[model samples]
Target: MRFMFKTDYEDDIKLFPHSGYLWSYGSLLLVLMIAPFVLSSYLMSQLVFVCIYATVGVGLMILTGFTGQASLGHAAFLAIGAYTTAYLQQFGVPFIVYFLAAGVLTGIIGAMVGFPALRLQGIYLVIATISFAFIVEEILARWESVTHGNEGMRVKTIQILGTAVPRDSPAFYYLCLGVLILTIIGSLNLLRSPTGRAFVAIRDSETAARSMGINVSLYKVKSFAISAAIAGFAGCLFAHKLSFISPEMFTLQLSIEFIIVIIIGGAFSLHGAVLGAIFVVMVDPFLTFLKDDIPGVIGGLAATLGAGAQKASHIQDSVAAFASANGLKGAIYGIIIILFVLFEPLGLYGRWLKIKLFFQLFPLYKRATFKRQKIYVKSERNR
Candidate 1:
């Protein structure tokens, strides 16, 4: 275990609090840089998705994690970015310019949503955001002239510096990784700034923040704008990565997955976003494997239970069909979210922190060190 005693105020806010962090982070970066060369093509593709999802996860982390606000419609911002990029690419606008433009447009839209949010809180805010998402989806589907409606739009290869970059190229992977790295750095810096502090203040206690002379409403709006902008940027990358876009791609299920990403990874930490993204991407194959094997397992069990071979086979086929359906993925996501909320409220990062601390302290570690504490208020007790 390494120990460092703070010698000055600056140490409190230092990005790397100790040399140990620098070494660990540097090593991780080195591994990621070489992964493309070593990993299979399928794994490389997964990593690309990890980067894209991490970008969106970080954006949600800013709004829901840092700012104590909830949005169920963030996928709408992603759709906006994706569609904007798709439209602009057809008109010969450079990727860089239109990519940033998507973020700007989505940020403006987020600010508009945030205005009504100033008067709402908790579940009300959540409902409003959900409504906003549905509205955006409707517009996208109805605006057939621009969005091509439900038929979807095909995206051309991204042009960077006058060279066409295919989505599957290593260069494209690096582009995503680069953007994700920049976003992580930017989020870390934002957290270290006064605005980030204000966000936390609002999250913890808006009344206390207001008493401290912070403009609670304004900062809330700012957080929404920043979060939406990041999501939009991620969406732009996602559009080019897939080379196809449609209204169905950005649905309520996608928004819920974003929320699940932060919840399972560690909603309050920047590292949680990346970790959650990796978890989501990496676990998908296992889920797919399970989906494929489940029918065989069911068939064998049914046969052993004295069912006729023909009946067992039919049952197995039906079960397999249902398991292979698109709803299975959504069901899995729902179960994960529920399980994480009920049992691991602090998320995977929180669990990792406990393990790290346990190792660092060794025999001195106590179970109660990480236990959740319950507060009982006299007023609520009486009620």
Candidate 2:
């Protein structure tokens, strides 16, 4: 009945918790079962967008979250994927070939970049990657023959095995959901394997990992390649979903957004990717709608209160007006990131884990300390 997974530790030095296995799988299954019924077409389409974004976010999580590499050029890899799909489709290639090719091509490019770039770390690495992102974008935008340049390209309705699936159709939503599920499950499985541990080891300390005989370079490149492949897979799906292709679709802003999703969700936790995607995409629209709709009702109430309420109405109007301007979205995201880093660096999933632990411990919660020692509980006890 417990909701959180317990981590093991040796003495005082703590390690990451491995709790929430059942809840993770169960929650996703429930969402998949009910999402079609609960979400309207507009919302469903938005959810598709979240899924695509989460796919890239998951990739970044593996690199940034697990391997401790910061990459601001993830969307560049996505662009590679999107353009690859678009170009291959133009040649009458089947959807399957295009999808696989996008992932493989990006993975190869990522590995090549990772080898040289791993020589740098921290801000320098970030700067290098950011430069790479802009470079990829410029190449895609200026290389007219291959990319069609800024003119962009339009993708036809995606047909699989000669069966066409329209963008807005429920079928397309289901397709996205299926991809999301597969990626999540695959990520979870990978994280449970030796490879995932190696990535985590490298993240914690490359020197230590090397001392422990964990092939640091191989894992580092592997992490980037894998992350790029996942991002590419997302792009393939995205090209079909949008039914159009452009460099604008893969902006630097989006690359930052992907990093935000992982940080807000919980770095290194796949579930964080899901939660962050749902939170960021869903919350923004709801906040926008509330800002637009609530003022009218508030204004009506202000009229009843007469002249004294005039001041209140003005204040409310100003606030509402500001919220509707779209600038607030960035402001809110900034605040969220600030608060999470300061108060919950592990992200929302970290907060969720704490909450679950609180309920699990009940009256004993008051004595519970947020320390490394708690991670050492028996696995049998957790189960």
Candidate 3:
């Protein structure tokens, strides 16, 4: 195994600690830069969505992962961004301006929502965030003059320097890729700063952070603003990608999916957010494939059991019906959360670390390498 020896204080904040990260990520970026030219149209689209979701995931990771703030109303911020894009696009403003306008507006709203909720913790904080989402959803629906209510607003193609950027074109893909890169860079820098350390300290224990002179409430609000701003950035691209915006698109379900993205990707790690976004962006399509194949398998099994053609058809239809329910997908998500919490709380990125460590240690590897450390509090008596 390669050992990294720290020589100076600057090494602690180096973006790439060693040559390994630099090379690996450099190669990855090279591959992605060339991907649009070689990949199929469908694959290109999937990659675009992955970038968008990953951007949102990183923002959430900053709050929920690094900062230990739990929020379930990111969908509201997303809606704000999308609708802002939809409304602003009509005036033919520069893409950068409206894109930023969305994030700023949403961030301000998030700060407002987060301010009062600072006194709450755990599930109560979650409820406060979700409640904010509910209010946003209601506003989007009732404000028909602006959002067009259930009718949904149409989004225009993105334009840059007088050129239209089609969603499927390489330029569009590169745009999304560039945004993702910038988002990751900004988030990394934030995590390296004193504010970032404050976030981690708050996450570890708000009480301790307060004792250390960290303004916990102010920082928490800042965290929400930053997280919501990131989600808003994702919304701008998501709006253009779909070519439409509707309140329904930014429901509680979508917020839940964001949570699922970070959880399955791995909490407290930026890599987990990216990995989770990839998994989430691909899940519906995977289910679609399964939906087409499962009924046939059910029918074949019934036939092999000597069931009549009518009986086989009945069994197949029943299976198809069950699979068709949207609730089934939600239930599947619930089960996935349960399983991940119980069996792999660290998530997909955590599993990758374990595998890497196993290969590195080989004969000397033990399960305890990844075991959770016990938390202890100190007092006059304990000390």
TM-score of each: 0.92, 0.86, 0.95
Ranking by lDDT: 3, 1, 2
lDDT of 3 by residue, 1-383 (tens): 98888999999999998899989999999999999888999999999999998998999999999999899998989899999999988888799999999999988988988789888888999998899899999999999988899899999899898899988899999999998999999999999999999999999877678889999999999999999999998899999999988888899999999999999999978899899999998988878876888999989999999998999999999988888876878898899999999999999999999999999999899998988885644532252
lDDT of 2 by residue, 1-383 (tens): 43444355332232223335467767867887688788888888888888888888888899999889999999899999989999998899998899999999999999988998878999999998999899999999999999999888888788887899898877888888888878877887777778998998887767667779998888999999999999999988888887788877777778878888998999958889988888777876778677987776677667667745777688678768876886677787789889988988878898888897789787778533655452322432442
Model 1: lDDT of residue 345: 78
**Candidate 3 lDDT for residue 129:** 87
Error of 3 at 252 (Å): 0.2
Model 3 earns a TM-score of 0.95
Local distance difference test, per candidate? 0.90, 0.83, 0.91
Candidate 1: where is the Cα deviation over 4 Å? 297-322, 372-383
What is the lDDT, from 0 to 100, of the residue 70 in candidate 2? 94
Q: RMSD in angstroms, all models?
A: 2.7, 6.3, 2.2
Ranking by TM-score: 3, 1, 2
On lDDT, the stronger of 2 and 3 is 3
Q: Superpose all Cα atoms of candidate 1 onto the true structure and report the RMSD in Å to 1 decimal.
A: 2.7
Error of 3 at 29 (Å): 1.5
Candidate 3, superposed: residue stretches over 4 Å from native: 304-310, 378-383
